[model samples]
Target chain A: MEKIIGFYPGCSLEGTAREYNESVFSLAKLFNIKLEPVPDWNCCGATAAHNISKKLSLSLPARILSQAETAGMKSLLVPCAACYNRLMVTQHELFENEELKSEVEEIMGMGLNSPIRVLNVIQFIQEYIYPGLQEKLSSPFGKKVACYYGCLLIRPHDVLNFDRTEDPQTMDEAMKMIGAESIDWPFKTECCGAGFSVSRTDLVAKLSGKIIKDACDRGAEAIIVACPMCHSNLDMRRNTIDRLLGYKTEIPVLYITQAIGLACGLSVKQTGIQRHIVRVDWQRLNSCLPEKMIKEEEDIHG
Target chain B: MYYALYLITLLSKYMAKEIYQNNAPHTLNNDLFHEIGISSARCYQCGKCSAGCPMAEDMNYTPNTVMRIIQAEDRQMDLELLSSESIWLCASCEMCISRCPMQIDIPKIMDYLRQKSLQERLQDKAANKSIIPFHQSFLDMIRYTGRSYEVGLVLDFKLRSKKIMQDVDLVPKMLSHGKLPFLPDGIKGKKNIQAIFKRTLRKK
Candidate 1:
């Protein structure tokens, strides 16, 4: 099947975490999937939107959907966690409240073409990309990687029905296909001190530290997450977290697409793997992988 | 359990004090009340934020205590512990936000309170002092790019704060491990990012 995915990266991918943006696009290309970037899409407003005016935050994305509706795109592949949540909220609102749908439609000047399936990059990879590439993966990640799904991904689960928002395993299942073992860590759905990271470092440190420490305690080499804000907190501030606790833990954090892309023969540059804070300790991480697989990869390259 | 008793005793004394001569927790960060934008307005006197808080055990005043202070007719002055380091303990777990019946963003309010206290130099922990440089770098990057460039932000935070030496050992370990990328992946339209930040910061 020629699957054409509509990609909406929110604001993070355009520049901030180019790694995530680059990897998703690369993975799409490598898998022979076509991605039509939604033009003129704005910030999803994240939880910040709801916290302010319920209408505006949601409308920010609804406006984009109105465009998608006109473009005749069947689904939107939102890679960012906050964007996924806002997009889902807009979808729910359009279905639940005709008045709201019409009001939003009137503002955006478009009629709903169809019910759009908003797939967090996880769903797209798990269902379409993973099954297709099971045989051709030249190298598996070959390490114990922890999956971090903060509240936005699955929480308010009624909205994001792709998986158990609280204990989302879509990413985990996707990882297995690429041949990396997934570790069960407790902070999977914990808040990485969201918007609080700005107004309150004292709180963000304690909260973020716990997540990193939990992953480290499980003997995991790195953590993978989907939210840009969560990525900023866990990966960017791990050092701050360590400093806060008087400890030294150097676990790298990668966006889920980047990690999965890795297992599927994606390179560091392709996955935006280098744009991380707690830098990857590839030596220790690679030690866990079977030597036979490494030799095969080198042989393939040589 | 102990928290309930503490709050009640405090409330009773607040009522008693009000009857004698009215005052509220004067030490409560006034700026926070305005920043959360509802510290005085929307809190329905519901105690759900404190109730569902996972880190409440570590706090002196539950989330409700501060709300009560803002609502109180008398000096709930003892509630100053919010600035002392108790409220700083909140995990941003958002159980407070998820459970609040009134949907008052208590965690956010608590967060602002933490920031206020820190800027006032009211913090008690050592780790927090180090975060100033991180915050400086983060905001500057955001101010410069309207978004953060990870590698640039990290290096700037370290060098600017002199915490570069603090993690000196990790540098070699990470470089040898194939983790370190010497050059940053600078974003295009650096000027646009700078413009957005300049505009946002000025407006804010």
Candidate 2:
């Protein structure tokens, strides 16, 4: 039986975070997990919709949920943290209030009282990738990594209800499975000043600078993230971050899927590693892995 | 529960006083509290929300102070808070709500306040000139397309701010990395999405 799941690669995936989208698709293929993009999915309305209009925010996610349910998708995987937050918050709201749910149903022009679960990237990996990880491991990703959750991945605990809102460690555990060591850091769940990346680069710089400085000071080779906005703040705005730090910091930010894909022996091109603003030298990365795979061809030739 | 009752009593007292003191009726505080589904009257001003806030230093009024401002029901103070850098600087991280002993959703209140501020055109001119326009352009992008069209959004914001040359150098880099595409792709059923926005507006 094919393990097919619905996928929602929100706006960021289509633009500004293509690497995240590519790496996720690559990893899914490697794991033989069939991912089906939800039919004609719209935006999750992220932080903008809620601030602009409450009805639009709720109705947007409600429409996505209703569409996913109609498409026969029981579980929808949203890789971007913002998308997951909006979808989960919507689900929490609609499920808790019957009257609001009916109102949303009327607005969306569709029924939305279905049991559809929205999973963040980490949760999706935990369920689908962890069990088969040992068999797929080609080399241990040996470098020390700082798992950055940023905000919205786990906050408003009652609504998200997935990991510990203050100190989430699921990403750490997931990295450990791939033979990568995740360090304990204060800014793991800190706000990276997302949504202000373009409008207020100075704030993003100061906040993302502190996060990068902490990770680098703790001897992390790379910072792992699940959110595209976090990546943009930490990766795209590197010049601003470096200016605030008063020095150039070369700590590469890798999407969790990219990190996992590399560990699973997917080529750098396949994993979209070169698309990052901060470059990752795969040869150096190969030397950094804990355990080197002894190729059957090498053994036979030798 | 007793705290809730006492707070309600206090609020009712204020409401009664306002009704008696003026001929013109205004449901300013009660309507907001109702819209957000939170009882600001229950806030005892513990300051936990302020302490947890990462951007509190940038805020002219701290999260805790905003709660007091809302509860006081003073028209001037309300306008001040609505136009203050505090609401504009809020990252909407939900730390205030998470740490609040009263379990108040301060972000929801902030959202309401931002909406009101924009509607009234009372946004802090110096600080929010860029911020308000950016948010409007973002919503406009979603309104036209089903999702955020990054190029269009950036263009809209730049045109509004008239700072087109600000990030010009970075465009090629972004394009090279396939981060920003030249054309915006519209999803199927864009009309349906427009209807959703329109219906939501009508409801409001």
Please state the interface RMSD for every predicted structure, separated by commas.
Answer: 7.5, 1.2
For model 1, how big is the iRMS in angstroms? 7.5
What lDDT tens digits, residue by residue, belong to model 2 across residues A1-302? 56899999999998889989999999999888899998988888878788778888999988888889989998999999998999998998888889999998888788986658899999999999998989999988988899999889888888888788778899999899899999998989888898987777788888888898888777788999999999989998988787777767777899999999999999888888888888886445432221222254356789
Instruction: Report per-prediction Cα RMSD to one decimal.
Output: 11.6, 8.2
The stretch of ten residues in a row with the least summed lDDT in candidate 1 chain B is B195-204
Judge candidate 2 against the unseen true structure and give its global Cα lDDT, from 0 to 1.
0.84
DockQ of 1: 0.07
Chain B TM-score per candidate, please: 0.56, 0.81
lDDT of 2 by residue, B51-131 (tens): 878898787899989988878888878778877867888899988888887788889888888878767777787556567
What TM-score do all the candidates reach, one by one?
Answer: 0.63, 0.90
**In model 1, what lDDT does residue A53 have?**
37
lDDT of 1 by residue, B1-204 (tens): 999999999999988988765444344444455444565556776676676565675566778876776565343453354344455555545566666667676656765555555545555453254444455565565444433444566678668656565545545644543444444333443453344333323332
